[model samples]
Target: MPSQPPDSSKPKPRYTLDEGAPGAFEGETVTRRKFMTGGAMAIGGVATAAFGLPALGFALGPQFEDGTPDRWQDMGPEGEFSVSTYVPKVMNLVADAGEAGKHTVYIRKFDPKRDSKRNADLPYVAISNRCAHLGCPVRYIQASKRFVCPCHGGVYEFEGKVAGGPPVRPLDRFYTRVRGGRVEVGERFSLNSELRRFSVRDPSNHLDGPWQYLYPSRPST
Candidate 1:
C-alpha cells in the first residue's frame, strides 16, 4: 500500500521569546543578570556601612561626653624660683601606661615692686615652653628679661606677654598655687588681649597689628 500523506493537522513546534532570546530569564520570573546585579548592590551597601559606621562614631562619640579633668602637679619648692627670673622646670603628665610624659614650663617669680604683688595669691607666673606661633620651645634670655623662640623670632616678656615677632598671643599661663612652701601647677589658660596688654609697659596697641587676626581671643580646649 502507498504511504499515506503526512498529517497536516499536527501542531508545529512552539517557539517563545523566553526560549532562545538573549537576556531572557531562565525561569521566566528571575533573570540571571538581575540576580547578579542585586547581589552586587547588597554587598556594596554592606561594605559602605562597615567603613562609615566607625568614622561616624569617632566624630560624634565624644561631643557630649565629659573628658578627663586636669589635676595639680607639684614643681618643687616655691623658694627655688627667684624674683625677675624665669626658672625652667620639667613636669610629667598622667599617662595610660608606663612612665608619664615629660614637659617643660617657665616659671617667673615677679618682683615685689611689680603690680603682680598686689595679689598675694598670684605672686608668680608659670608659662608653657611651647610657643604660640609654631609650638617651638622658647628660651629665656635673662639679660633681656624675655623669652625668645629659637625657631621664629617670637619675643615674649617675663610676664609671658608677646612683645614682638610671630606669636599671636601671650604664652599660655598655668594655674599656680603655693601649698606648704611647694609650688603646684595645674591647667593652662590662654590670656585675652586685654590681660596680655596689662603685663607690658608699651604694648602694640594697633588694631591691625601683625598678629591681630592670627589666633582666636580664647583658645579652644
Candidate 2:
C-alpha cells in the first residue's frame, strides 16, 4: 500500500455561540437550552426529595423511635364488672381532648373457666369497640353474645376473637389493672389469630402468617 499525506480538520467549537447554537450568548460554553434543562432537573430532584423524604419518614420513622406509653386510665370501680358478661363503659382515650376523647370500651371480669390461659393474668378483659377491620364502632349484642360491626358486618366472639367477615386478627385489647378500688386500662395491644398479644397496630394490619414478615411492627406501635 502507498502512504498518503496527513490531512487537517477543524475541531468542534468550545463555545456555544462559536458553534452557532440557537439563543447562545457570546462566549457561552453551554447553550441556554442545556442550562435550563439542567436547572429544571435539579429543581425537580429537590422538589421530589422534599415531598418524598417526609412521607418516607412518616412511614419508617416509627420503627426507630423509642418509648412506649405506660399511661393508665381509670374507667370505674371494680365492683361494676362481672365475669359473665361485658359491660359498656365510656373511656377517655385521647388525652386532654375532654368529651371528644370518649370512646366506648367493653370490659368484663377475667374468667378462668372459659377465657384462654394466655390472657388470664389480666384482672379485667377490656376490649376496644373499634372494629379490627376498619375501625367502625361495634356494638355488642347481648342476645347473640357477639360484637357486630354495623358498617362492614365484621363479627367477633365474646372473647374478641374474629368470628367472621374481613377482620385480619382478633379485636384489639388493653392491659387491665386494679388501681386502688377502681379498674384501670393500660396501653393497647393487638393479638394474633391464636390470641397471642403483640404491640398495638393500626386497623387492617395483620399479626400472623406472611403478613407479619411483610409488615413488621414498629417501635411506636
Candidate 3:
C-alpha cells in the first residue's frame, strides 16, 4: 500500500501551438477557440437587444393623436372669390402623429357667375389638382376654358368632367361649406355619376352672355 503513493509528482499534459518545441503555453493561451466563443456570445447579446427593445416599444410607445379636421381653416372671404372663375387656394393641413409635415391641399373657389347660375346654394367646389388617369396635376387653361393634364394631354371641362383623353373616370370633388362667408372645403370624394358623364357645349357656335354659363360650378356638395 505504501508503494502506490510514489507516482504523485507526475506533470499534467500541456496544450501548445503548431510550432511547438517544448510547449511554451503558461496559464491559458490566447487561442482561436476562446476568441470565437466570446465573439458568438457578444453577437447573441446584440441580437437579443435589437429584438427586445422594439417589442418593449410596441407595448409601451406613445399613443397616436386623433385625426379630426380643424374647423377654422383659412379660405379668403366670399368677395375675394370671383363669380365665374375657379380660383385655386392653397391651404396647409396639419400632420398626424405618424406624419412628419403638414400636407397642402389646393382648394378652388367658384366665381359668382358660375356659382349663381349652377350652384346658387353652394358657392364652392373643391377638386383635387391631380388628373384621374395618370395622376398628373391639372391646370385650368383660361383661354380654352378646360382643365388640362400636362403629362398625357387629358382634357376636362369646368366641372371636372372628362372632356377628352384616355381617362375613363372623372376627377374628384370635395365637400364644401360656407361659414361666415369663408368657404371651407373638406376632403374630396369621387365625382358624381351625372357630372362624370356631362358634356360641354362647343363654344364656336354659342349665342349667350358667355360660354362659361353652360358648365356647372358645384358637383353635388
**Which of the numbered candidates is closest to the native, going by highest TM-score?**
2
The regions of model 2 sitting more than 4 angstroms off are 1-69, 216-221
Candidate 3 clashing pairs, residues 3+ apart or interchain: 82-111, 82-112, 83-111, 83-112, 83-113, 84-111
TM accuracy, model 3 = 0.47
Clashing pairs in 1: none
**Candidate 3, lDDT over the whole model:** 0.55
Q: What 10-residue stretch in candidate 3 is worst by lDDT?
A: 198-207
Which candidate has the top score in lDDT?
A: 2
Candidate 1, 116-190: lDDT as tens digits: 442345656877777767777788889998999998799988777789998766776666787898988876655
The lDDT for every candidate, in the order shown, is 0.64, 0.84, 0.55
Residues 19-91 of candidate 3: C-alpha lDDT, one tens digit per residue: 2525345554555666689999999999999998876554333123122234445577777665455777665
| Model 3 segments more than 4 A misplaced | 1-72, 93-121, 196-221
lDDT of 2 at 190: 82
1-221, model 2: which lDDT tens digit per residue? 98875444767789998878888888899987888999999999999999988767755653464424488888899999998889998877777889977788899999999999999889899999989898899998989999999988899999999999998888888889998999999777788898987667778898786565445454443
lDDT of 2: 0.84
